[model samples]
Target chain A: MSNNTAIKIENLSKMYRLGQIGTGSLGQDLNRFYAKLRGKEDPYSIIGQTNDRTSEAESDFVWALKGINFEVKQGEVLGVIGKNGAGKSTLLKLISQITAPTTGAIKAKGRIASLLEVGTGMHPEMTARENIFLNGAILGMTKKEIKAKFDEIIDFAGCQMYIETPIKRFSSGMRVRLGFAVAAFLEPEILIVDEVLAVGDAEFQKKAIGKMKEVSNGGERTVLFVSHNMGSIKTLCNRAIVLEHGKLVYDGTAEDGVSYYLNNQNNASEKNLLQRTDRIGNGKLKFTGIKMLNKKNKSVNEIIAGDPVKFNIDYKTNCDIDVNKLLFGITFWDQHENKILGYSTDEMGITFSNLKNEGYFTLNIPCFGLRGGTYNIKLIATVGGTKMENMLDNIENAYSMTVLPGDFWQTGKANRSGNMALLKGSISQHNE
Target chain B: MNKDEDWDIILKPKRNLLDINLKQIYQYRDLLFLFVKRDIITTYKQTILGPIWFFVQPILTMVIYVFIFGKVAKISTDDIPQPLFYISGIIMWNYFSSCFSLTANTFTGNAGIFGKVFFPRLIVPLSQITSNLIKFCIQFILFLIVFFYYLNSNAITPSYLIVLLPVLILIIAVLGLGLGLIFSSLTTKYKDLKFLMQFGIQLLMYATPVIYPLSTIPAQYQFWFKLNPLTHVIETFKTAFLGSGQFSLTGLLYSCIFTTFTLIIGVIIFNKTEQNFMDTV
Candidate 1:
């Protein structure tokens, strides 16, 4: 580990046991111990599959990560991107030494601090001033070092008024401010942050992003950032890696890596939305097919703002049932799992109370107004009743859509702000 | 020791079964202090009685024991005043029990912090030991006050072996910490061990001669009770502080060896379990 290489991982893999303490718990461990004495391969390790959240698990063993190999150089910022359960967090966990890998090794130099989540180790009962020292020490800072930066941390967190008050009395926003302040100011040789910007309000997110950029560009220590926000990744990271199903799919410059991950990854899984076992609903009705199309009815991965995008939901009913109150709805959620907008058949006063068979429903937005980012589509099919079995189908994260930047205003300028949604507005020129 | 920066710490497919990395623990000493401070501070916050609760627990338990065991059960204290003898026993027994249970819950209780960050992991149990030590020190002062009163009244005599006060305390602390670490590590894999821990410590107190003198257990059963490592520590504590109980030099030596062995085995099992206990816990 020279000064040039900050972290080096080779053949790193993590296997997780499914269920709790019944089968393949201690018995398999003893068996593995006996086999190792005879110089044989681990009997339990041979049956693990890659970490995929969808699909039925075959055995009690699953590989949360496998065959992972990467090297991060000193003073370089690396971004890790992957779909949910693609082993992004697991990889960071291994690198941070929170949990040891099952079958490989990770070697790194200097002190490493990981901010896996906001307010990670902050004690709720301690005062803000005291918690600063505790969180700093947790990240490997000495008492004298934290004292030197005490004023700076207090000023940065902007909790000067309540320094002596316990943090449980502070609002959640104030707590995040203090937590992020301590984490960013610890000044370790290596920093690992996972979705930290997802916390706090919009203004705080902007400030946190700016601080992250300055920290990554300091040219003194390395940084590893993991987030679902493509914009931040492109702006802050110099290099990036895309992981799919616990395997490294792409590794390159930040721009190309994000582009490849967004464009090509998860295409097959997205196409087979209904086959995924992650959904819950009655077996009477289920989603059969779903697709997104451009104005020309051509299938596309993304659509520009102000364009007419079409969503078609194909359905199949198992038996003839209540058609008078049947409902087909689609909800849009941003990458952060925040619900953006929703549209439903019942809410629109459209009655599907007629006889139905295998058919499809089309929902067309006049302009398809949504911000330029990937959004998750949740399919909600139900009957109008409060009964326990009224739900026909509720498949969350069934499909995804990507909206691109467009000049909706026709002013020869695009929307440069990071607003959550786009709108088509009419303006009348008038002097007040 | 190899100083090549190529691998400051190499994590392999399988860890050495008994590698208690003392250097790593030393490196994270700052974290240990911080955790100890957190444990001490956060425990008393928001309560009206505050830290008074720490003193109240053992003092109140001693008063009840004096009333029930000394007055009701007619147990022998070897002719010494009842409260003085019972208070000393309660103080020592309380420290060991609190330290044992607190450190034993290390893996299960702090799984949130342990899952998100990585340090030496030993810092948690070490902090538990130190924080409980602070509590024990405060309670010990109370015991000293009672002892001074009994001495002025000529109710008891002090032994020359009172010089071994620190040794007796050290052995009990180590025994508690060691047993706590072992239970904590094992419970992560088999949660049923936790239930046993809850009741076992209570039963173990009776077996250790905390409420009664060892001489009262009858000569036939004396050797059986002496087999408990804690029996020697508490017996020695009473004999040294008040000069009223048996003080066998060989029993103390046996306890010294047993405490060392438990601590060593405890640390090895703890270090091994901390690596992957998160997956199971």
Candidate 2:
């Protein structure tokens, strides 16, 4: 290991047993023990399957993390991007020493602090001042050091008046504020944060992201951030990796890793909607395929801010049900997961009485009034007419489109970027 | 890369079961102090009696023991006044039991914090031992008040072995800590062990010479009673305090050996369990 390498992990793997914990697990543990005593390979290693949390694991043991190899340089902010159950958290847990890996070693140059979850050791019955000490202790800081940083942490968290009060009385946002404040001030040589920023409100998230940026840039500290949110990853991380099924499949710059992750969504659409794993619905009826269509009805991956477009939602109802109470809708979100537009069949006051068990619905837009950005579409289906009782289906990020500026008004151009909605109006001035 | 000879720390899987890593404990001494404060302060928070409950518990237990053992059960305290003798035994036993039960819940109770952060996990068990000592001291004041009253009345004579009070307390502590460590590790995977421990610990009080002197035991049951290591510590404690009851170096040595071996085994098992208890717990 060179001096510039802040952290080095080699062949790290963790296997977790299934079914009743600690009962049958003791047998497996003993097996490994006797195997090691005989200088043989790990006995359970052959039966371990890759971690795929969304599916029913095929074996009695699953490798939560397997064959992970990586090296982080000094002052590097590495983003870890993965879908649910992709072993991102497992990697962080191993490196943080929250648990031991079944195999391999991790060597680092300096202290490592992990904010795996905010307010990790914070006691609800203890005062915030005291919890600061507790949290600091868990983060491997001395009481003297916490005392020195006391005022700064409080001022940063903006909970000075309630510092003496028990943390149970504080709102969740305040708890996260104080939690992040303590973590940011530690200034450890390596910081590992795992999806904790999502707990805070928007303003606190921004502040936390900025603080993380400072931690990586100012003190020559390496950081590993695991988040499903690609936008923040792009904003703060210089390099990134993509993990899928307990394997490091892609390693590159942050921009490339994000693109690689987002591009995987294309394969889901190719597999058809009913087969997609990342969805929840009653399955009474389902969307077969959804695509963005241009004015000429040609499917396009990218659309413009202005000009006409339509969403062709092809549906095939499997079982017989009342078609009149059914409603179709789509919600669009900008790059930052902010809702930009929501359109529904109810808004148009149209209920088709002649709908069949197998057909398609085309949502036509006279003018696509969205500013320049990448927007994702969520498909929704509801039943029970105006009562809207049953939510038959709701798929998030089902289809994504990149919108650019186009000629809308007589000014010959539309907006360039960063606006949620576009409006159309003409101001008529007379004797001004 | 060549085992990283230049690195500061290398984290690997446990190679030995007895890697207690006392240096790590020494490095995190401040955490131990903070946890001690947390336990002591939080124990009384939001309660009406607050710190007074600390004194009331042993006093009330002593009163009940006096009524049952001294009056009704007709157990002899070796001619020592009933209240003073019962109070001393109750405080000592209370300290040991408290240490055991508190540390027994260490892994399961702190699983939330343990899952999220990494520190010297032993700090939790050690802090339990220390915090229970604080409660022991508070109740010791009650034992002292009764001791002084009986001393003025010429009921008993204080032995020179009274100076060995710290040693007796240390043995009791180590015994409690050892048993607690063993139970905590077991209860992580065998959650039913916690409930069993509660019932088992309560029954164990009768086995030790707490309310009655070992001399009260019949000749047939003396060997079995001596088999309980706490019997020695408690008998020696009474002999050291009131200048009565049996006192022998061999018995004390047996207790010491039992305590040391139990503690070593407890620590080894505890260190092993802590590494991955988050998974099973």
Candidate 3:
């Protein structure tokens, strides 16, 4: 570990046993004890090893993170972006000392405070004033320092009415605001933040992101931020680390990392669509295939956000049905799993008539008015209030579209917070 | 920047198998003081009787013990007045029992906060111990009032051993904290232990010298009685406050050793458990 390097992780690995549930057997425990007694490395540290005596299992362990090697320089803000369950949270937990890695050593230079969940130490029974001190203590802040920053924290949180009120009485937003304020004021040498910024409303989120930017710019502190929000990651992080299935797939510039993440989602549509049963809901109903074609009937993976788009769903309803409601819903969710907009056939008054058996349905929309981002389509067929077919295909990313820069309202902005953009009409005033 | 200096404090990380950092704990002493204050203030904040409940609880427990053990069972109060005898033991035992029960559920009770951040996880238990100590001090004052009133009423004379009261209280605190941490760590894995902890403290009070004097038990059971370190602690507390009670330097020495050993082991296990206890907990 070099002094300039804020964090140095050497061949770090974490493996979790699948179903040999509970702690391992007494024999295995004794074996481990003996191994340690003899100064031998843990035998079970081998990847995919199982020590179950009765069962000759193929593989009993899943590596949450495997052989992750990286060096973070002092004062660098490194963004970690990955798909859900890609071991992002696990890595943060390991570094924050919340959990120990199964193997490897992680060495860091200074005091580390992880705002994995803001206000983590806030007690509902305690007043905001009391909880601030409690939260500060939990974040490793001395009492004197917390006292000095108390007024500033309350001002930043923007909650003045009930500092003495129990946190249980505070609204969810207030709690999050206070929590974030305490964490933001901590000023630890190293700050590890998970996707906690998604907790508050748009205004608070903007404030939080601004605070994060300020903290990173302080020049002596290092930050490891993990978020699926590409726009925020792009704006704040100088470098990015991308993980795929516990592997460090990409590590370099933030732009390349975002593009790499987007490209991975793009390629997923091909191989992932064929494995439709696994991708969609529990195998209650199976979507055999989904295809998007243009007016020329050629397969197109990308589309303009406001352009005419056609969706064809080939699904098999396994059960006999009556009063079946074939619900075709398109959910436009951002990379961070925030639902931007969702439209269903029922919501649109475009429900299909009676269908006797399982077959294919071709749904066409004249104009899909979504901003540029990856969207998912969920196809469901229910009979008599019982769902017979429900399929969610993320491989196609449902629909990958790009809304180009235009005179469109808020075109230059990265995030379109509003549900929809209305066409503008200007009135000229002639004054004497 | 030299890498050696960067990772200096962490590399050979203090073998704090007893991961409780006394220095770091001292650093957060204000937080601990506030937590104690919070517990005491909140306990009586909206109560009709307010701080009077502190006096009421032990006085009431002493009355019941005097009735059952003193009058009915014909048990000796070690020549001390029965109320003073029972109240002294009750105050000390109340502190231990409350501290033990509270500390035992530390992780389960604070799971929300524990999962959210990383602190010297020992802070919760330390704060709990300190807070219970404050409550103990309040009740001890009440006990002193009762002691002085009895003395003025020509009932009993206070002993010089009363000077040992602080040492006796310290022993009880350490013993309770040690046992509490051990049980709290175990409870994270075995939830059934929580149910036992609730009832276990009350049951263990019978085994200790809480209601009856140490001489009441048969000589054959004396070894078993001594096995419970708390029996020695309670006996010594009574010996220190009430004039006529017995004091065994040997017993106090045994308890001090037991408390130290248990505390060391508790810290070691607690340190290890806090690292990844969240997974199982």
In model 3 chain A, where is the ten-residue run with the lowest total lDDT? A404-413
Candidate 2 regions exceeding 4 Å error are A26-42, A265-267, A271-288, A291-432, B1-3
| Clashing residue pairs for model 2 | none
* Chain A TM-score, each candidate: 0.69, 0.68, 0.67
lDDT of 1 by residue, A123-193 (tens): 88999998998888887788889899999999999989999999999998898899888887878888898
Using lDDT as the yardstick, the better of models 1 and 3 is 1
Per-residue lDDT of candidate 1, residues B1-281 (tens digit): 22445656566766886787788788778888888888888898889999898889877888898899999998988898888988899889988998899889999999998888888887887888898889889889899999999899888888888999889888988998999999999999888899999899999988989989998998999989999998988888888888889899999999999999999889889978888888888
In the range A345-428, model 2's lDDT, one tens digit per residue, is 877787866766777778888998887678888888878642344767778888888775544563532343564788787789
What are the chain B TM-scores of all models?
0.96, 0.96, 0.91
Best by DockQ: 2
Off by over 4 Å in 3: A1-3, A19-31, A34-44, A47-58, A265-268, A271-369, A372-413, A417-432, B8-20
TM-score of each predicted structure versus truth: 0.82, 0.82, 0.79
The DockQ value obtained for model 1 is 0.34
For every candidate, give the share of true A-B contacts it also has. 0.65, 0.81, 0.46
RMSD of each: 8.4, 8.1, 8.7
